[model samples]
Target: MSNGTDMALISELVARERLFRARHNPEIRDCYYADATVATSWQQGPLSTFIGAESKEVDPRFVIVGSVSTPVVHLNGDKAYVELPTTTHMRMMVNGTLAELESYRRLIYRVERRDTKWKISRLTSINESDNLRPVIVGQDLHVIPQDFNGLRSSYQFLAYVRQAAGGQISQDLLGTDRPEEVERLYKETNAWLRAGV
Candidate 1:
């Protein structure tokens, strides 16, 4: 291929990768090469049911199936971290009706950049909830931290300190003698966290 053609292909692959990371519902089979294979050892299903199924047929249609939120994606040049919420649904073949099933799964997708395309060769999926910590305690602290912050001293301090570090906390963490550069410090800290440092 000519240099311009190769560049165009690379750009297309990058765009597809971005769209996939953004939770766009592209048919994987259509985008992936014919020889591509999604490992079945990590898949959840009857092992023999769809061994030869096309990638498009088996690929996800929805990023978040129910009340669950879409997972966050962190991407760099040739690597990405995708945290996705998997769904469980029961679809009746005879009636063609679908019902939400009582099941949940979490997945971390590791993407690799190949010569002309980006492929997901490794997927770690789990059905348990051990890793997830409650965003809020009994009283919706995530929604209203001020009302609950004062109830307990130690936890309040920790909470506010963390929030302030992220610039989400109130102004009292540093006291009346707070530094003038508090906000800038907090912003720097946030950037550091994003850099995975």
Candidate 2:
């Protein structure tokens, strides 16, 4: 990245990205570039599909995710790379029992500016780790859901819960278990930013 990068401008875009995903605000299109793309374990394609697939009903037991680390941004002239570390916390009924799934991931974003408008060009994620547990303080998970059968351990519970909720996931998503894929993503996007493409 060139020294001319204005981090302040890039930071605002990051803030708007988070706000656009918040429950209270529903202006998703306004926050993202018209052609932004999103790729993750649960969904891969347009940004709309990723956000639209989420359940609209409000429930305290569940949340889309919880960000644990501040965003790490790399700003170039008209493009930037942003990475936010987050954890997913979702509680739901699994096999007639209340269970929660917590998953850790790195949210990657490719931001760009055109005609003086800054927005996300692509959004991707890399799974780190995850676990499942009974929501109740003293309860135990007895029956392991069939959906969790052949998922990657890094985000197994997350993939299982999402699929059980009528959503599909990509089993070949980038994850901690696959160092090569992670390396590829980082290298490819970083090159994009440097090339100013």
Candidate 3:
């Protein structure tokens, strides 16, 4: 398939993910292959568990804000491998208070062409950082963040790469030219994760 075709399929997948998060619609699973496997940083086992969390009855207001960056797609016959950067902000109300959490993830989706449609067969989420706090209205309360040492390793690797490039890394490579900004982001992410929300 052409790159354009691959990207279109990825775009559809992203849109489906946003729809699922916004509406907690179980029918959204139709976007995935029947035996799709999903691995995320926060949970183990089936992707159903993650999707089911949204279906649980709750009174507190829940919101999910997400974005998917341009994906690198490689098409091989009937299969395609897509890698993209994603950011998500999840907010919920608890005991009349509001809490928000942010996470950065590198998502890899294995897409396969079934007949004339493309379906996601496998998804692997590489958690870059978790526990980012979003500005929330009213009282400030959050969940205890989980410790992910990979954040430190990622930071160190970026720093090394920047140094190797004579202290000048392209924004395209680092996502931002400022190394301090990356450190600050990771710090905030770690704090949010430690908050456990």
- Whole-model lDDT values for every prediction: 0.37, 0.75, 0.56
Candidate 3's TM-score: 0.58
Error of 2 at 49 (Å): 1.0
Model 3 CA deviation exceeding 4 Å by range: 1-3, 52-61, 92-97, 134-197
For model 2 the local lDDT of residue 132 reads: 85
lDDT of 1 by residue, 44-157 (tens): 332122133422222244342332335555555544445555543322111122222233444444544567555554444433221112223332223344634452231243
Q: What is the alpha-carbon lDDT of model 2 when measured against the actual structure?
A: 0.75
TM-score of each: 0.34, 0.82, 0.58
Residue 9 in candidate 1, Cα distance off native in Å: 14
Local lDDT at 122 for model 1: 43
TM-score, cand. 1: 0.34
Which candidate number maximizes lDDT?
2
Residue 21 lDDT, candidate 2, scale 0-100: 65
Error of 2 at 114 (Å): 0.9
Better of 1 and 2 by lDDT: 2
Rank list by lDDT:
2, 3, 1
Which is better, 2 or 3, measured by lDDT? 2
- Please report the candidate that would top TM-score against the real structure: 2
Worst lDDT window (10 residues) for model 3?
168-177
